[model samples]
Target: MRLIEGTYGIAVLHADFPDRIVVARNGSPVVLGIGEKEMFVASDIAALVAHTRQIVTLDDGEMATLKADDFRTYTTEGTRTTAEPTTVEWEAASYDMGGHDTYMHKEIHEQAEAVDRVLRGRIDDRFSTVHLGGLNLDAREARRIRRVKILGCGTSYHAGMIGAQMIEELARIPADAEPASEFRYRNAVVDPDTLYIAVSQSGETYDVLAAVQELKRKGARVLGVVNVVGSAIAREADGGIYVHAGPEVCVVSTKCFTNTTVAFALLALHLGRTRDLSVRDGRRIIEGLRRLPGQIAEIMEQEEEIKKLALEYAEARSMLFIGRVRGYPVAREASLKLKEVSYIHAEAYPASELKHGPLALIEPALPTVAIVPDDDLLEKNRAAMEEIKARSGRIVAVAHREQEKADHTVVVPKNEDELDPILLGIPLQLLAYHTALALGRDIDKPRNLAKSVTVE
Candidate 1:
């Protein structure tokens, strides 16, 4: 008899006892694949698409034991139960690394296609609305939502910051983002009139899952903006929209971040139209969303230049990233990518926060990357660039136009002010990729990090 303790979503396939296997899940995902004489278990369906499309998704507090062709399941309460295996339509090619050197590079280049995938069939041009099947909110209900709270961890939390900005901008909803880890432990007041969004690429992030469970337990509705289908958060949340960014194998998230931001734009557009947003503005946002794939492709063409820049800065000991408003989250995520893969000590601060305390750290040896959006805050961002320049700091600016104040400028294609983050972030992803490549770091599997953080 095998003893299974607490809720650590685990799947075991005993090669010694080939036929005997045990699977248990809670707040994480486990899929079981039944083959002719073999069996498989994985955290993601992408891993099992090669062998079998038919799979069983184990729910929270559920356990199953398999012996070749026979299987039995039991609830955490010791009651006998049954789970149905469903057929997935995902193609095997989705998981392949293709010809890229690493999964990170492949995923970075896939951003264009990934963004297009998220926007493909969701927009309704005729009615100036969006159809997010998993939102589970109607026109009347969406209009009634007074406030929106987005929760996530790491990269997802950064995306949530961007999402909250978009929601507040377009939908005019009082929106904000919080780290799921903190949100769950704070004894948050669950309001029925507020929309709660849990953003995660795997949908199995422990903190995010725990937050979702807590919200659900408190009788508050939750929506999941997740990439992986049939993940714990996806299945447990009242409803949600799939990011459809495909499988991200790299430890540092790339495509999922961009695609999730695009997904947020779609969500924002949907919410905006439900309220008093004019048709003209909604159409403009829709058109901007449609143009992202091409814009991303255009920005990626500068990879050679970015690589050269990375090589130039490869010897740098540390880095600083700063931006204002929408660009703030981009700075945070870009800094994360750089540190995660390149192992460089990096910090991201809001441009407004620099003078308050971070200004003391600026120096000639350290490089600064500033996001200068061609919006109302353009002058403020330029002023921040000047501040870094005053400290003799080398500045690399990602902006819609060449920044005269920056030492070097990487110009990205301009989009609407609200949509600028989606476009402005692409070059930084390339910057991180090329920087790590120049430093000869393990690009796909970063040291001391896993692709998914299943444990708290």
Candidate 2:
């Protein structure tokens, strides 16, 4: 043990140890699953979920010795410790693909239901706001929050971008998101009145976990926006909102990303109500939130059409995704999903930025996917589409209505402008799925990527 350093989750057993096993974690995750007269230890709770739904998650610098019917938790100094077992809400079946061909496909189909779970019992129709009991912040404390900063990595980092925008727009607070790895290493200024949020699907992501720990040590208020309960980030943050994305088994995320966006919407609503957001606008946003599940279903009904579109675009050597404002993040996420699932080279840029440099890349062989919502930016995006058209670039438009300038159109349902990103991003999930299917790429297990990046 003296020779060990850095992050590790180790379990050892030997002939001399009989039925007992020793387990410890420094930087990785370890969950102790409790069963009938037996205990199971694993890096993730999913491994022992079928046997038991009760788990005790170990903290950093914690070690445990487990037997058939008993276990003890202790610190590195050898003092005994205790942690209460918490019930895992996710069923064992949730981790399975059910009858789907792959975990990715199953997760894409689960978005509507997953979103509903994150929103259940949180909507306040009477007051036109949201109830987030986990925040542990009263109205006064919430009002004192002057700025917001979000930290995450990869997909979670992209989600944080959207969350930052939402907080800035709705809550009237200046907000932004940065890569967790960079945030922790850059010696960022931590303010007492500024609120920080750490986002991670697994909650065990080492970079994000380290960022949360650093923020807390600096006496800064940090909240965790994570899916997994009892995950390291969840335990370390001062308070947070659970994304409630059930069990996501696919390496390429689908449902969890959607659920995290929905969770952010609720968080934004809560913050907005505490500030200057009027009750009328609050009710309007709440109504729009209620319509999201049905709107998602509407997008799913277009799978066959999107599959055909994917086949049409699959032969392209590369692709570009373009959007503006709220639509920009949608384009960024779509670009990522395609590259992750289809093994296709794709790039996303702000629609306005094309003229700056990306316009040179547009050609007949290079296709483009444009997100054109029916908002204030509609005219500007149309102008961008015209630029792509003039360059002879084939355009696949994901818009609220058909675009005459584009070669193909995938029309999505219209929602409130603030909520547009959530609905606009849904069709692209299917597009990426079908594109991968057309190319015979692995949908569930994409090469060189894991579901959760536990290590740096």
Candidate 3:
């Protein structure tokens, strides 16, 4: 009331009546009855229905300027006020690619441009070096670092596992990937020089947050690799890099996972250079990174084949995923994607570890998904396929080239082992997405789950 009078440069008054009160603003008055000291004011009748069945919506850009025994009046741009109300409306077009039929199909088609956007401006094409200005570690400090700890959950955790291998092999740095939930509870050593990197799509994951807080308490240098801007983890970390993959509405993440992996690969190569790793070797890896998006696009063209394979195995209640070495992490992610969306029971095992255990679970009713890239492990994975066949387990293989060894195969274009994960990951994601659709499961919001787990 005071603000209104002040703005209009007019004296306003209030008077008590038997069943109501008379209020005046800029010499115009409005009368409203009181019930338990509650007074309602709104811009529209719809907003006042709950408060009182009787209401009057003020006219646009007008103040309720007068109050009297039975009525009120309003006026626009009062004596001394110049403010005006403005209405704004916004609409967004659907990402749906007209009846190509599924979101997974549209997303699969978007991979090439998505990956390209994630890699843009961060690399120098002429020199093949990563430009991460926020990585504050100098050469001497990087060399002094003896251990690395990566913390995350779900798919991000699997990415961390793969990152551990890259860090160890390229930077020659001993690295460990810990499930953030477990890492927080376990007794661990951390110091000022120790580097702890946290990966999260939302940067507010409960377990990841807890682990980062614990590491900070122990005085470790913390870094965040996240997709969201100004998220909790990003604000808490000493320095960080944004994945810049944009908003991923799907509950099962697609582009963000590959983008995060690309960022980690770059970070690993950067650390390698800092620690005096061979320039020739680092450039070769960078060259592979540059070509990754196109390779993934080529692989994505096989979505129809992947969909057919998913349909073939849709009736199976249980599935097993197997991989060796770096592929083990890919296997873990594949299993997670399947279980998350399709509600199918799925498990991932290191192919080499099958003989020790997992082999006991294979049977005719279960389908096996193997990540069989054309590498040293191809024969080993084929051997595992043979075992699954011996047990009569239906086989669905994701390989670099088509193979007759399995009941079904979704082939990807071949690349080095390091780059194979990026190419091979797409079809598995598509498979899970389409399978979920076929089962009529919610693809964007799975039951009993939040996009980011923010509480411990």
Best by lDDT: 2
Local distance difference test values of all predictions, in order: 0.88, 0.91, 0.72
What digit string (tens of lDDT, one per residue) describes model 2 on residues 274-325? 9999999899999999899999999999999999999998987789999999
Candidate 2's displacement at residue 407, Å, is: 0.8
TM match of model 3 to true structure: 0.77
Q: Which numbered prediction scores highest in TM-score against the true structure?
A: 2
Q: How close is candidate 2 to the true structure, as a TM-score?
A: 0.99
Q: What C-alpha lDDT, on a 0 to 100 scale, does residue 94 get in candidate 3?
A: 30
lDDT of 1 by residue, 76-133 (tens): 6778897777777677887788999899889989999999889888989998878887
**Models sorted by lDDT, best on top:** 2, 1, 3
Give me the overall lDDT of model 3.
Answer: 0.72
Report the lDDT of model 3 for residue 177.
89
Candidate 3: regions farther than 4 A off: 1-108, 125-127
lDDT of 3 by residue, 181-251 (tens): 88888787776656899999877676787688778887889999887655557757888778877555566
Residue 82 of candidate 1: its Cα lDDT?
77
